[model samples]
Target: MQLPVEIPGLLNYWIVIVLMMVGFFVVISHGNLVKKIVGLNVFQVSVFVLYITMSKIDGGAAPILDDAIKNYSNPLPHVLILTAIVVGVATTALGLALIVRIRDAYGTIEDDEITNQERDDA
Candidate 1:
């Protein structure tokens, strides 16, 4: 008899889900713009992990063509994930730069505080 939730089998999936939720909650629940940017990065990483996990095959070797190897893990997804990570890093840098500018203009990085300050200025 097997239990519904097998920790060994689903550990990686569960971890990914937890990371995704943490990122989502941080983005939605945080008042700080910098924290939100960090959360977005976290979410991106979880997506990368998911892709990498799906591409991995048990007892599989590298994608290099080899007569000695019958099973090879697909490399396309890993390549895509690498590209996505580069994009994500660039995006996070842009977000941080914007946050710095916002902080300079509003004197606060908190979302609500910035909104209130803008309202008062008008």
Candidate 2:
């Protein structure tokens, strides 16, 4: 029986999954706050790739309506992704701001060290 995610046709999906796993690993395993943010961005990029891949239709043209073009790729996904990109930028900025604050307060961005310091203080 043929699986839905065959290796030949779904290489992009496989790549995305691998990227997600790498990102997830970095986020979970790394103690540095900056590394976690980089991992999160990687994960976000993989999701964006998945969405774009899913929205693509074979032989589909841009969403311009024309008599000659039968298949038109859905623009909604692209639009939503654009909004997500904006939100992602804002979120990243906020995260950086928080990181700066955390660094100022704790003098370190490593999660383990910060927690250890907190424990010593408290």
The models' CA-based lDDT, in order, is: 0.88, 0.86
Segments in model 1 whose C-alpha atoms lie over 4 Å from true places: 1-7
In candidate 2, position 121 carries an lDDT of 94
lDDT of 2 by residue, 1-122 (tens): 22465446688899899999999899899999989988888888888878888887766688877898788788888888888888878877888899999999999999999999999999
Model 1 C-alpha lDDT per residue in residues 1-122, reported as the tens digit of each score: 23466447567788899999999999999999999999998988999989988887766688877798888888999999999999999999999999989988878999999889889889
Per-model tally of clashing residue pairs: 0, 0
List ranges where model 2 is wrong by over 4 Å.
Answer: 1-8
Q: How many clashing residue pairs are found in candidate 2? A: 0
**In angstroms, what RMSD does candidate 1 have relative to the true structure?**
4.8
Worst 10 residues of 1 by lDDT: 1-10
